[model samples]
Target: MTNFRIWAVGCIASFFLLGVSLAFISMNDQTQTTSGTDDLYEEIISNKAKYEKPAENAVIDKVWKKTPGIEGRAVDVQASYNKMKKDGVFNEKMLVYKRVKPDISLEDLPSSPIYRGHPDKNMVALLINVSWGEEYIPDMVKIFSKYHVKATFFIDGAFASKHKELVQMIEDEGHTIGSHGYLHKDMAQMSENQAEINMEKANEVLYALTNKKVKWLAPPSGSFTMNTVIAADKLGMETILWTVDTIDWKQPTKQVLLQRVLGKVHNGATILMHPTQVTVDSLPELIEQLKKNYRIGSVPTLLSENR
Candidate 1:
């Protein structure tokens, strides 16, 4: 009887010990699985962070130093930096590394006397008249480069002749060059033949310098007649006009200029501006605002997308 009791007690103790050991093993396995899942989650988030935000050593600040409004001017860099941080969209680095290829098949567009680009596209063209403000061009170019923006620069023949190096620089930067008439004269007041002479003269200079044919013409002061359109068509250039005018030429305050642009801008809008102080001041912010809804590009880019 004593041997039987002892045997039963030993069996019960062994079973309890075995059960405890099994439970411990199961708990350890679950902990390892949970730990592995957490590690994977952290890795995924780290990988995403690598691409979503701009690198800490990005060259944007250096580029801004070369830009027009901020260069050689007393600008609060920290304030601008703080503002950019607050505005998440502006904080994103401009993805200018993407090279836009020209679509050779889109040569048949601008089939109208007055071209404002395709209204259906979610894009905007910046038309910068370069007859005056030679000092501002470099900064403007830098700003455009910083934003990876390609704008259309309409060169007056006189301006081109005096500033050939600047014109070459603009072309080399991959921006489109167009004619703003030979002498910034009103083409509307001239006869068809006279208009042709002005157009041809400007076209000749631009071609001589850039080796790229002028495909668009923005008449000075946006003044043009039927004769101007005929002359442009003869030269195989489209008569380009603006959908939005910044009126920066009048030297409006930065706040007012910004408000005017933001209030009037829409998809497929062509903004007319000159290389003025106001324009330089307003450009960076303007580009950021427009980028939210519209792809800011050259007129040719808009035309190609539409085609």
Candidate 2:
């Protein structure tokens, strides 16, 4: 009887030890699997998912909600603070993000196919947004011609219609023409239908006035949505935003404007400024300084992928 009891006690102890060993092995396997899965998730987020441009629905959803990272964080802060300025989620207001790598280079900017052979080594494209009175048109043309430089003008459709001759003058000077929308409406507030309307109307009037297929667009006040992008794409227009904003519209002095432009202008930079008197007054000096310091390149040429 004593021997049988000992055997039974030994067997029970052995089973308990085996059970603990199995449990530990299972837990270790699970821990490894969890670690591997986390690593894979991070790889996807950083490598593949980061470059995918948001779809139309995704853009609107992000605007209403918020994107998941630092980019979204910046947009959220700006949108909340600048509610009166315009919506941040739509249109093509964001031409480039600062955090993105390998930005546009003068070597990369697309040139007019016709001008491909006659490349200007130090020519930069100037883009002026014309949304104000027409009294400055003559002065604009005169100043640009005086510098022997041709700058692109993005005109509001309503303004263009009223000043047909001025719009023609810009085109006649051998400068590029782009659309700035019909009424200067902020794209973030418009419903999808309204966004389409704004885009289509601008395209219509632009073609009517210039007889040129509008190939580019700039949203008023640097606001855009994915819908705005789609609309522009549908109209065969590529959206271009400014890398340098002179904020001449704020009535800054020509010196301040010049400082802003000089500080921000870079390779493949599409600088934005209104065709206000301040900008006109500042251009000659700014152009002279830029020519002396850096190579100026056109937008199309700046966006070339080959470089």
Q: Top TM-score: which candidate number? A: 1
Over 159-207, each residue of candidate 1 has an lDDT whose tens digit, in order, gives: 9999999999899999999999888998889998999999999999999
- Candidate 2, which segments miss by more than 4 Å at Cα? 1-123, 295-298, 304-307
CA RMSD for every model?
15.3, 18.5
Q: Please write out the lDDT profile of model 2 over residues 144-237, one tens digit for every residue.
A: 7886766778889999888999998888887788888988989767765777789789878888977888887887886887666666666666
Superposition error at 259 for model 2 (Å): 0.7
Measured on C-alpha atoms, candidate 2 has an lDDT of 0.63
